[model samples]
Target: MLSVMSTRDEEIYRSCAGELTRYATGLVGPFDAPDVVTDAFLKASGSSRWDQVDNHRAYLYRTVLTVAMDHHRSSRARRAREQRAAVPAVAHQPEIDYEILDVVERLSVKQRAAVMLTYWSDLPADEVGRLMGVSEGTVKRHLDRARKRLKEWLS
Candidate 1:
């Protein structure tokens, strides 16, 4: 029963957490992923309407996108000063799913968000459109453009 199954509110946090973090990392940078994801989660947790939310996952996702975009702006301004010199790279996480995540990496923010919510998260176009606050046609356009780009790279 959806009732006893840990409120949809918390499920929202768990379900979209990985995809949101991945999208944020791809949009901004991996180093800021955890920070942005944590900020977004904080925002969602603080919202007054969290209890009234019928689709909390979508709400949290939208919040993540907004926070990530903000982080993108803030970091761009601070980038010159913050650029590291001769930082040693570490090995990749062995448990990471490289394929879909790779494809996600290559997409633009809008394209990636659209594709992630639609395909990876299995949300409908209309719901994705609502989450992004764009028209359904815009959602389709994002999907189409993302698909074209993916095909070009994968073919």
Candidate 2:
């Protein structure tokens, strides 16, 4: 369906896809993340969904989460098999801002989504409000609260 979309629709969907990919990548490994994101897009663009969306990006995100969770569940056996197959022991690399992602994780899903969609995805507040099914003022409050938490955590 996306393959046959008009230019404007394609552009909007592309933006959605790009963010979905990033979100999926965070949820899974980079090696398989693209496939996960694309699979979510495929599910999202299927016939049943094309006519029933208020915010397509948020719909795509929910799709990504569902797909990624399924992937993690089904792939666990394979992951364990590969883990025992003479694989190099990967050490945990330190993140400079693990504190921030940690603090962000402490937020409720809606609050975290609100912050990430606005600050990380670079969408406007009103647009994020639409995506997260909240008013603009509500989105602003969530973002402000998330930011304050992050600032206090990282300071």
Candidate 3:
């Protein structure tokens, strides 16, 4: 049976969807943005703590990020499995920028999320920490490591 969503839930979704989509886009790229947002909302709304949560927007943000990280992990595993099992094909492969991918791959998921939320979202470190469920110092450390790695790799 389909349970009706509460009016507050609908209101929250309407207000937050655009921002969440953009945030997800920054995390996982544009092509996967919509699915990330949808998955995040589903997980957030279905959680047992959903009703008691005072900050729904922040909760959803964390959920979206978690789902995006999971997506990355599964995607990496799938690619590895395919590469191991499949024979080399002569089909033309699309050109990819390995330099940028290498830079991205060097950072941990937390570091990437911290950088994206801080730089792309223009949010302060404390806010980014809150959204990411980390302390402000942890967020700063992640950013510092990310910047050092990027500078070293790009130079």
Candidate 4:
């Protein structure tokens, strides 16, 4: 199916994959980010409207965001089920940077996306707002709340 993608589509994929993966990582975490990106690209490439998209980069970003949200929902449901089934017991935890992830995970999805796009991607507020389908002011609000939460958590 990938072989059927037009040269333009391939170009878009190549240029945007790394940034999209990073965005998805912030939304859904590193473990699921690549798969989220892959799924987004696959969906975009397979869409009947692929050739009609005027803004391929924006389309890809939106696709990645949607896929990441779906993954987050599914993961949350799975965790709930596992929690209900498993007996309470201590398990050896891996040494990793939980502090940052913990703070990020506490954010609402929109706030997290806003924070990641604004800071990590270095996108302008207007562009982040466009990608998130919100006004620039709303994006700023999300970022404000996210920053406040992160500050509280880190302190």
Candidate 5:
């Protein structure tokens, strides 16, 4: 069934699309960012309370975070399954800055989200907390822990 979005909702989506894509890209990566944004907008449009949202941007951010986290979890599970089936071999790996990606990937989902929202998206801790449905203090804690781990790992 086709669901129609109000003009206000359309406007909100248009205004927020680029920022949300950038935010989602930070969380998920470039390959999946567009899909994640699309999914978030679709969910927002489908919501019965779409017209009632006091903060459409915040609502959209939260939706994108949820969708990206779901994508991350599913991708991790798929990779785990693939790794289990892979044949063992001593192959030389190419040198690259994979350590950064590895460190980010090792973070708990909440910590990763907090770090991305804070540093990559340049969002304030309070806003990141609102987007992640946590308190500002919690967001700070996540960022603190993530920074310490990243520093230690990169050292």
Candidate 6:
């Protein structure tokens, strides 16, 4: 069903678009951020609950994060599929590093996001929290827990 966005919704979108795009960029990357933001807005605007959401900005942030994660998962799956297909044709290849991959796979999505935004993007905890729609302290907790898990898993 097609949902018609109210004028207020349009206004909210206009106000939040830049920040949302930046947040998406942090979650995904600059190359895919615009597409991710557009996809997120489409998903959010179509939701039945869009009209009733108390915090539209936060809702949009979460939706963008979700879409970005889905994009990441799909990309990973596609690459894995290609690698598997190539395995039969190329018998001589470097062995897969399953241990490191397994360790990364063990991390929760939030932990991975926290680590990526923190270390990969070089974003501070407060900025990560803003993008993640969480408190700065929550971001700190996620980072601390992620560090501990990585340390334990690697050691």
* lDDT for each candidate structure: 0.73, 0.67, 0.83, 0.83, 0.80, 0.75
What TM-score does each of the candidates earn? 0.64, 0.52, 0.76, 0.79, 0.76, 0.57
Per-residue lDDT of model 1, residues 3-117, tens digit only = 3334654667778788777766655566667788889887877777877877776777788888877776677646665655425448463354557557666667777678767
Worst 10 residues of 4 by lDDT: 88-97
| By lDDT: ranked, best first | 3, 4, 5, 6, 1, 2
Kindly indicate the candidate among 1 and 2 with the higher lDDT: 1
Q: What tens-digit string does per-residue lDDT give for candidate 3 at 1-155?
A: 68877898989998999889878766665545678899999889988899999999999999998998998777767656855797765654445555655667778778888988898789999999999999999999999998887887758
lDDT by residue (1-155, candidate 6, tens digit) is 55467788789999989877766654555545677889999898888898788888878877888888898777777656756675453333345555655666656667766776777668898977876878999999988887788897757
**Candidate 3 lDDT (Cα, 0 to 1):** 0.83
Model 1, which residues run further than 4 Å from truth?
Answer: 1-16, 77-107, 147-155
Which residue pairs in model 4 clash with each other? none
Which stretches of candidate 4 lie above 4 Å from their native place? 1-3, 77-96
lDDT of 4 by residue, 35-149 (tens): 8899999998789898899988888888888888888887877756865797744653334467777878888778889988888888999999889878999999998888787
**Model 5: per-residue lDDT, tens digit, 16-123?**
998998787667765557888999999877888877889989999888988888888788776577558866445533343455566666677678789878888788
**Which pairs of residues clash in candidate 2, taking residues 3 or more apart in a chain or in different chains?**
none
- Candidate 2, 1-155: lDDT as tens digits: 23565575567577777677666555554445677887877777774756668767777776776777688668777767865784543744333355444554556555656766776778898887766667999999987876776776657
Question: Which of the two, 1 or 4, has more TM-score?
Answer: 4
What is the lDDT, from 0 to 100, of the residue 87 in candidate 4?
A: 71
Candidate topping TM-score = 4
Give the better candidate number (4 or 5) by lDDT: 4
What lDDT would candidate 5 get against the real structure? 0.80
Which one wins by TM-score: 2 or 4?
4
